[model samples]
Target: MNRVLRAALFALVVAYLIAPLLVVAGVSLNERQVLFFPPQGLSLRWYGAAFTDPSWYRPAINSLLVATFAALIAVSIALPLSYVVWRYRVRYAKAVMAMGLAPFALPPVITALGALALWIVLQSYGRPYTVVLSHGAFLTTLPLATLTVGLQNLNPQLVEAARTMGATGSAVFRTIVFPFVRPYLIAGFVFAFVLSLNEYIIAYMTVGFTFETLPVKIFASLRYGYSPVMAAISVLFFAFAVVVFAAVGRLGDLPRLLGADETD
Candidate 1:
């Protein structure tokens, strides 16, 4: 593409992705209680409300708690799983990985229904922890995929050298394997964290009328009336997500993380 054409295309794509967020942020500053594009007047009232109101605070806390626990669980499970798949390459490795990622592949509504049924069978209703578990189930796949790519790029010679130096299996892994994969692990953790934070459908279905997360709270507010507070929350969430991904990009090779050929 020519320089001008390429620049125009890129700008269009950026606007397409950013327009909704910009609108939400703009509406959040409106002095009016109701949501409107091209906000009637500018004020920080909604942002203040989100910060001070218990109604918003509680759900925000819930979201943070769930996202933190889910990210931890996802990383814990994915580390070993990725290692096994990369090192052993067992006969059913692909099948096992696919099954682990099944929740993400199916329609989200189907996953929500399945989780609800499973929760009912397990008799764990009205539990916020169940929502965390469900989020972990889906988010683990992203970390696993990221770690797998990192492992694939790793040179086996490093491990073999450690072994030749009389290093034990665990020692070799700690000294060599772990360091090489650290960047990927960080990337995976951030990915899982963000996914768990923003996820809504599963949280909505599985929690039912019991517990509420940030997204659920925002969604409920929208039903009653649009408020600038929702926009404030959106702005916060967007800022957080951007910071996380930017940190990941800085820590690791962004192009490689996105499946580009780093060799070129």
Candidate 2:
């Protein structure tokens, strides 16, 4: 009886979570230009427009570029930070890591405001690269966390053995540390990339006028009127996230990468 009740509760929770997405999916299939659920008629024209139309396509390309570079920057910062904290055990490393995590810890609106002020002070507001850099800085915590977990799970004996065999610092990392942490590194990149792809406020604040990402563009379109294309884009993004996470799980020991301990 207890197991049956638990299963029923789980199904209810899943349905509650998925209900909104299902509504959006239905709206995206509407034949009319206006947003309406339980469509007047069913069609996929909005999805086609999202791909072929320059307005939609361009912002999507911009989002892809920003997300790619932002993920790279995040991983670059996290890799060294995690390595230094783990290997050297520097006294200030924890403080530095905390600083790295501050952006994510704070409300996103706060981070967006800060990024806005930063670009304005530098007189670099509206530049295309500003969004990428701001996003990279804000999203650093994800990769930092994943990499830290990977390093914690690493066996110190391996590093000691490599050093005793006369391996240089670079050699030791390349042969031992990096291999152990590579999965975590990839997971971290994926986390940062997907979040960056969907991020809105920072992109809008940093480069709203000059460079538009997909999310920014979607909001920009709202002033004119609601379009089913926005719904279509939302569904497409949801699909993308689902596919990326599924791939990560399929290709890796996802639970272990995410810090789950090995179970016999």
Candidate 3:
């Protein structure tokens, strides 16, 4: 009876989470000009329209570019920091990591507000890179987590063994530490990229009209009207996320990187 109840609950939760996306995807195929839930009839016209529209295409391209850069930046910063935290037990490392994670932990409005203020102070408000860095900083939490988990799972005896053989810290890392943590680094990068791809508040607040990302564009379109093209854009974003997860799943034990206990 308990097992049956658990399966039922799981099904309920999954349905709750997935029903909205399925609705949007269904609506994207609507044949009528109006956005409707039942989707008057099935058609692929909006998918073509979404791809052909410059407003949609331009923002999506910008989002992809910025997210790619943000992921790179986040992983580069998080890998070393997480390694030092895990390997050396560096003083105040937790505090420092906490600071780095603050942007993600705080309300999005607060982080967006802060990034906006910093850009204003530096007079760099209009640059696309501002959004990249903001997303990078905000996403540091992901790589930091996965890398820390990866480092924790590494054998300390391996480090000792390498040191006993005269391996320098840098040598030990490159040869021993990096090989183990590389998958987590990549997982973190994928996480950062996907998060940045979907982000809007900081992107909108920092660059305003100077740069636009897909989320911002969709939001603007909603301000005036709604269309099946927006649904198509959403479905495309959903498909991209699915592909990213499929790739990440192939790259590593996705559950372990997410802090699941491998011992289990």
Number of the predicted model whose lDDT against the real structure is largest: 2
Q: Write the per-residue lDDT of candidate 1 for residues 1-264, one digit (tens) a residue.
A: 699999999999999999999999989988878688888888999888998999998888888899889988988988988898877758887787887777778998998888899898999966988999988887888888889889988899888888888999789789888998888888888888888888889999888558898899988988977778999999999989999888877767888986666658
Q: Which lDDT value does model 3 have at 222?
A: 92
What lDDT score is found at residue 220 in candidate 3?
87
Provide TM-scores for the models: 0.95, 0.96, 0.96
- Across 1-264, the per-residue lDDT of candidate 2 in tens digits comes to 699999999999999988999998999998877677788799999999999999999999999999999999999999999999999968999898998888877989999999999999999999989998999988899999999989998989989998998999999999899988998999999999999999999999999947889999998888767888888999999999999999999998888888899744
Order the candidates by TM-score, highest first.
Answer: 2, 3, 1
C-alpha RMSD of each candidate structure in angstroms:
1.4, 1.3, 1.4
lDDT of 3 by residue, 77-175 (tens): 898788777877678988888977777678899999999999999999979999999888889888888888898899999999999999999999999
> Which parts of model 1 are misplaced by more than 4 Å?
none
Candidate 3 Cα RMSD after full superposition onto the native fold (Å):
1.4
Candidate 2 — which residues are off by over 4 angstroms? none
lDDT of 1: 0.86
